[model samples]
Target: MSFPAFDAHHPPDKDLIDDCVHCGFCLPTCPTYVLFGEEMDSPRGRIYLMNKGLTEEPMNDQTVRHYDLCLGCMACVTACPSGVQYDKLIEATRGQVERRYERAPEDKAFREMIFQLFPYKKRLRLAAGPLRLYQRFGIGDKLRKSGVMSRIPARMRAMEALMPELQKEQKVPELTEPVGERRRRVGVLTGCVQQVFFSQVNSATVRVLAAEGCEVVAPKDQGCCGALSTHAGREEESLNFARKTIDTFEGLNLDNVVVNAAGCGSTMKEYGHLLRDDPEYAARAKAFSEKVRDVSEFIQEIGAVAERSPFAVTAAYHDACHLAHAQGIRKQPRQTLKQIPGMSVKEIREAEICCGSAGIYNMVEPEPAAELGERKANNILKTGAEMIVTSNPGCMLQIQASLKKMGHDGLPMAHPMEVLDASIRGESVETLLRR
Candidate 1:
């Protein structure tokens, strides 16, 4: 008895697969390809595997391993000259893999635990309670000092290392009035990990938007934008989250739906295609996607109106892969940062390479993720900047962990919104650095 490689639901599209011209342009930008120099790990190589799976090849451990190694950072989309839609191809391929391939018991359970925990805010917060205690009491440091970390599994250790210092949660109001005159009305997506762990980024985003003459609305009912699930190829889960998110902000009359996190914005902007099969949400999703904008992109579109006080710091700007490559938003962030008086934005080498924080890639594939993170950290150090500015929380944690490993842990990392908020609020450079 023979079986087909992919089930009947939605196999990777042959038309899309044929679009890959086997061009080597994606090699340098691919994180796994750059790290291992493996053809199967590069976008072109993976597209070949996907094509084989579509024909005679069956889905097996080897094929699945190659797919699993992909970070889904979409850097290839930016690098490709033929404009291949590798994002859609890989996403469809992963969905097929998740449905058809049987994994080892441990691997299956680990993936299940991640999906269960990371997408839900409440579960994450509950887990954070103990983690906060661990960080607060310095148990994490003590464990590191005692040299017991070596005994732990690499995945668990990666999770521990990526844990950012939890600060007191800063809540955003459901509605915030514009400072001077209302120029536009916008609804914000307060993301899952972003809200629980990096709430300050959301708060600062609201503040900056309001100060810039935008009446900001943060619907408390909004949940995960499904970037994690979407990237991981949990098709139904991601689409469900997408439908719920669309429903939450649908009735609110707004000029734009703003997002701060790079990953979230990229996923939210693709809701139309993600839900195109659904008759109910296909049209609604398209409308919603058009309004979705990265906060920096939105601000740049509207033009910054608020006065910027001097923030005297030379900061290296790390372009989060989702923002720069996935969304084609390379310049808006730097342009926004340059608006700050006395602020200099230095660019990192290999600006297109991912920092090993492609959603939960670091947590799942710890070794490769660490290699890329260290590589990114080395480039960042070469910039000689006082602080690091990026738009994604995952990048913040991954880069911080890598820098710590290199004994440069004191280097400050911040979101662009936080830096912009400090400049607008007239906060001292010292105060901003401490944050």
Candidate 2:
């Protein structure tokens, strides 16, 4: 009853596997390797397993465990000196794993629940109603103090811990005119989790773009960018979302498609490769991808036209892994933040390492994700910054939870767009610190 390691459908590419020189450059930057020091958790080690799957062995529990442990942070892709495409390799490998392997019933059901809930905005909004009441009534704290939390599944506990305080939903208009002459026309991706839970971030993004003389169009019809599904290797589901996204903004004739969230931007930028097999969308996906830009990246490119008011504060800036490693967007965010009149941006140690919120990794793999989150939180504390600034909602939630555990709960966290928006609108520094 032995089976081939991979089926006839798209497996990990043999040529890409051979591109790894095994030079060990990616070892130090890998979060799992840094945490466990296991060779099996490193990128080189995973590539080795991938090679074995292709030639020597069948896909088994051990092999799949190693692959599942990957955060898909793409730090290895940034660290590799040989230019090995670990991003493509791991993506292909995960897709194969999802298709070829069967999971335990509970594991499959849990993953199914995540995929079902996370990728839809309306479902998430509906779920948020209950979460708001839980936070307001302090049920989460009561459950933990009563020791009832210990009885819950680890993944469920992790999910509960990572919930951010829900606020009133801020809706973006279908079209917003520039403050002055329109320099560029851009369409924005109001993401799923971002739209439901972190709507303020989207509102800030639109305001900042408008203030900078850009005609901003946020199509209400747009849905998930498929970042979670794509990262988790639900290939067909991801492709479907990608095609819908492409279709949403296709006829708008915009200068750029702006994405504030790092995870969504990374996956949206890869629609071409993800849909390369689709005869109808192969070319359209590539064209749509070409116009995709991270909000800070877009701001940096267009140059700042709005006046920046002074809001003096020392801030720790976290480089979201997808923005930095997956898209090579290291400098743009820093440069954008520095544009503010009196802002001081401090860098975190091990900036290249992940903060353990790679899509849903923190929820599914709770222990490792917690370890990495605490490690990142400690690094942030050393800077003594008054606030934390990052571009991704997931990173914000992960870091906030870890900092809360460390009793630094008073420290505020904000998206870079919010900071910029506050400054541009002459809001007081207290406005940001109070958040």
Candidate 3:
């Protein structure tokens, strides 16, 4: 448990590193550690490097390499008994890297594009619609088979494999009324990728929120949560988006800012710090952050489900790393899944392990991401489940694409909110059932 003794070039907050007791309990859960079997890939070891970095210790190539390889999955944060706040450590280190280091031209361009486009909803929608053509035309299949992918740079190929086919999008209407009396008024975030990729998840989110006697606002003004940007250390752009978000929902008489996408929710919850430097929007940003809630947790808090009926479908609930670890929400989504009639929630092994879709990590680091996704898919398959339920759009794509590649693609992938809505509305989710 003895950590490396040295000062980083720029030390992080003393309180953060001091929380790590250097417990190696998180070693097995880390994707990089599991893959490379290197001490530096382990949580304790990373903390050591982070500590060293923050303490002003000199960085070697090895230190940078391991940090670069990190998915920032936060599985270690969940596994640590001492409650080491690895999420902050990793993010702080990443921000420092972005400020101080230089990446290759392609890496810089792609990462910049992700940060720029992802936080702006119009840009995302406009971009996604055309990309949909490439996906549906099976360009991915062509690339995989043509050896053209081999000729390209590894990182670019990695990006291509991460995208899944987008069916027609179904953006929610601006306002939706619940079936019964309104008990709460909330704003639902129509996330960037969720809108273009898993639009149905947003639909179900509105349906469930409505079914619970709440009025839902799918505000056209609420853009992305700046998640992909923030996670990649594009701090200024993320902060700008955060300001717009504050202005987006400023007037809503909201009980909460309900977020169905876990990664977005996690990012939103951290808006306090994301905009800390904004003189005009700092207070508003923090206020907006406090109002943010994961849809499942909001549902749980409002007693959205009165009872759980026994359903017979064997369903596996895949926990998105951001939801379970970064945001510290591990139970409500499961409860919602269990509420469906004739459904059985089955637990998968290594459920907390990253499916390798952290922000754009899958696209940027495709091989490892794919390996993790396939590993996750295999474990999910062993559950004998008829369907897999998850919260994040990225996780949905990663798992669904992996399952499809493995020929188990026929099995369904959906958000838990969808399941809850289907049960209450007695609506059959056939599209959800379809791969």
| TM-score of each model, in listed order | 0.98, 0.99, 0.91
Name the TM-score of candidate 1.
0.98
Residue 101 alpha-carbon offset, candidate 1, angstroms: 0.8
Tens digits of per-residue lDDT for model 3, 1-435: 121332343335568788888768898899989988988888778777877765556655678777778998888988888888787777777776777667778878877776666666678778887788887788767977887778987766665655666677887989998667889899988978788777878887888788788899888866776788778766676777777787888798888889998888998999887677678877888888889999889888888533433345678989999999898898888877766767788999988789988888887777888899999999999999889888898898888778887988788877888777666766555644754
- Model number with the top TM-score: 2
lDDT of 1: 0.93
Top-scoring candidate (lDDT) = 2
lDDT tens readout by residue for model 1, 1-435: 222577766788889989888979999999989988999999999999988887889999998999999999999999999999999999989998888888899888888999999889989989989998998899877888899988888998999999988888888999999999899999999999999999999999999999999999999888899999999889999999999999999999989999999999999999999999999999999999999999999999999999999888999999999999889998999999998989999999999999999988999999999999999999999999999999999999999999998999999999999999999999987897887
Displacement of residue 418 (Cα, Å) in model 3 is 1.7
Model 2 TM-score is: 0.99
Q: Please write out the lDDT profile of model 2 over residues 1-435, one tens digit for every residue.
A: 222688767788889989998999999999999999999999999999988988889999999999999999999999999999999989988998999899999999999999999989999989999989999999999998999999999999999989998999999999999999999999999999999989999999999999999999999899998999999999999999999999999999899999999999999999999999999999999999999999999999999999999989889999999999999998999998898989999999999999999999999999999999999999999999999999999999999999988898889999999999999999999988896
- C-alpha lDDT (0 to 100) for residue 94 of candidate 2: 92
Sorted by lDDT (best first), the order is 2, 1, 3
Q: Which 10 successive residues of model 2 have the least lDDT summed?
A: 1-10
Off by over 4 Å in 2: 1-3
- At residue 20, give the lDDT of candidate 2: 96
